[model samples]
Target: MNHEITELKFSVRFSDCDEYSRLKLSRLFQFTEEAALADAERNGYGLWNMMKAGVGCAITRMKLRLNHFAPLLGENLTVTTWAKENYKDKVIYKDYIIRDGQGNIMVEGTSSWLLVDLKTGKALPPSASPYPIPIIKEEALPEKLDILPIGFFPKKVDQVQGKNTDIDINHHVNHCRYVDWVLDALTKEEMKERGVRSIQLNYIHQVPLHEKVDILRFKDSKHHAVFFGMNAEDMKGNPLKARCHFQARVGFGE
Candidate 1:
């Protein structure tokens, strides 16, 4: 198809940032996902169109790298996304880039998604789409997204419950929502004192509504703390929905 990258513009609000005035990771995901969705809609095959046709897209995996805190609140940022290619039938790969007004790259991401039937929740089998698929060249990650190397540590977790609002068109906890869960699990004092420097996530499974999830914390010498998320099962059990790792510091300026 076309050679243009789908771009979305955003002005960060106070609500979109951490206490340190850095853009929240979840909000960045929202902007990035919206850019991708808008591009799909323009191509006649994005979230809105899929929903209207009783289909849904599920982002199965995503990993993000942040070079610095997102431009401060109220700053304008541009996000661009492109499909990598038609991958294995219903699955496709996509890449995202976030840039500041100065044209510096702020965040880079790569994600994998599968289109599925709404009713069956099964991956749609290979079929020719009525529309032409845009070839999104895969963006190489500086560091690969793999299962976080879980270190042996005593379990110390903060709990959260998935809410109905967490479900998306796919009827599962929205992928980006997990970032909030991880952040919210932190104490207000903790959040006020640090800003996430960089973060990565690898989604393992879709979390269902109202499941009590655990944010398992680990001691990290490199980052402030390490966190692993689990749900989709009873609290005592372990069925991981996603894994996240991040580094935090005092942040740029105040």
Candidate 2:
């Protein structure tokens, strides 16, 4: 609790695994989020404190690299996360590592977050927080995740409406649900043929509950695909008019 970094232990449950018994990417996201919240709470920037201060933290981007062998169901994992020392005013960088019981790295990730005013939803500087969480210099991924670019006519593969389960305390669709949507856009056969090697997400806007999201995808190559989540009207054949909720890049392996 006194350290800048926080580590928590978790056991992969049935719900956390996929058909292969390997941990789902979305579940891994949830675990990392839990670890992050724990770190913030211990550092005095918990939800109640932030709310009292009229500010809330929102994640803007995340990039994750998965090991060849993902964490399996029932495996014990240690999730460690820390906030990076801020050189900028408006954004915070955070890094994470998930290790198995055998001390092997299962997944590594980095994320960017912004402190926003609760009333106006405008981003605030780090100086505005009720408590300044201690930060470390360590970086999980030195390179920043880029914004995914799509072609002119990216195909609309599927559509999904935000459900109660997709909503979080922030009253919008949780970030992990977007991961699910991205994966769902691909077929089981495609996933089995091309295993997911890495994923990067850029969350552009909050998705309100019950809002229908159109999943559009551009397969750059046999091993890579970029996806965008937009509103129904936004996909009326114009990329320029698309009200993008999020953009993502999914990399696959042989």
Candidate 3:
């Protein structure tokens, strides 16, 4: 009665690609999320179901390893996702993989999520779920590194407000939008010159609609970049004073 793994097929569209025609990293996240949602829905623990039970899921961290170059527009891709059997510290883990039509792996990722009481906004244990969640023993991409911290990155790259379009069913900015905000911190030339090899993000707090956020970036190394999203008004003069919304680290290929 439970589908331990879920797969979805997709075709890269112009909308899903960057100006150079490669698949956008944010779109890749979206595809992965769609597969996860499909799996949950099939298992009877979908968004609405969880909400009706007074709890909702929120992603806490994500790490993705990419191929040498992103997939091109018009390419056919298949995304697969599954929940790991191990649930610890009130957090659930999910794994994802994306392959091209030729079955070449394009991306491998793993994400951590927590369940929250919708009414109180407090984190809940996995046992709070109304349905018996099924899990797969396979680990698509095992997490190893500690999540990136919100360092005091001096360069403030951009500022943005959580728009209506950025809001998701959970009434918070969608995870993919956070991906976009981080990637946007990089210059087009830098992105093209240094193709992304890996991406890691830690979602510390959710931003509601119309909330202003400050985007900061640090080119910490020749092949690495770090970013932080903080409350714009709350930042004051010290980054430490602001509530960090997310932290991201991007590794670039040579």
Candidate 4:
């Protein structure tokens, strides 16, 4: 399948807003995904349709930079998405959010996607088949992890069991499951005492099916802690997957 640059427009909904009336951080990713998929469908290569043809698109990693907050109720917001470049095994996709009327930039994000064979659940080379999608030069990715600090420390490690239900059609852990992990890493008392205001995460790598990922947590300061996911190594103690950084806000009675 050929990757192409596509754009989509949507309105900010009441469900999308936070207490401050601004769009929630997590919903930004959801909106981006929706727009990108809509663009693909408009171009005749929707993700599900591609999957039916024996190809599946998988998000391997992502980086999001939130800029100006969008809080206008019923105001249209335009989301533009396109593939920056294509490699033999993966393609990089970029998304930009802007106010529809003024074109003011709201958020910018980039995600890396891999094409895989539906049967084997392994990555397929981009050059393995003729992709109808147009490819552009790859965008430069950030060298450092971008995330804010979350107050509080986890007293225990969280265990996530990847069952069949936890697996998506692509046979990997669902992206939302990562969010579940982040929330689960915190104790109930912590959540009751302090609400999470904002969060940022870089998806470094995919968690494979049936693999047990240990959720590790460490407090960097009084108001900040780092959380990551890791799998057991063969014997040398090398991590099987790349580490991801998660930042959250926690304080006061919500």
Candidate 3 global lDDT: 0.85
Query: On residues 2-45, what C-alpha lDDT tens digit does candidate 2 reach at each position?
Result: 56579999999998899999888898888989999998998889
Residue by residue across 1-254, what tens digits does model 1's lDDT show?
35678888999899997767878878888887889789888777866666777776667667666776557878889888887766666667788888888898887877767777777867874254444557756574533345566655726466776688888766777777877876775677666555555555667656667766667766655545556665524445543424332211112112
Q: What residue runs in model 4 are displaced by over 4 Å at the alpha carbon? A: 1-4, 70-75, 88-90, 137-173, 180-214, 221-225, 230-254
Return the lDDT, model 1, position 113.
Answer: 70
Q: Which candidate ranks first by TM-score, i.e. highest?
A: 2
Regions of candidate 3 where Cα sits further than 4 Å from its true position: 1-3, 150-153
lDDT of 3 at 42: 87
lDDT, candidate 1, equals: 0.67
Candidate ordering by lDDT (highest first): 2, 3, 1, 4
lDDT by residue for model 3 (50-161), tens: 8888888888899889975889999999999888854664788889889999998988999988878989989988877787577788887877446675455468899989
Specify the poorest-scoring 10-residue window by lDDT in model 4: 245-254
* Cand. 2 TM to true fold: 0.94
Any residue pairs clashing in model 3, and if so which? none
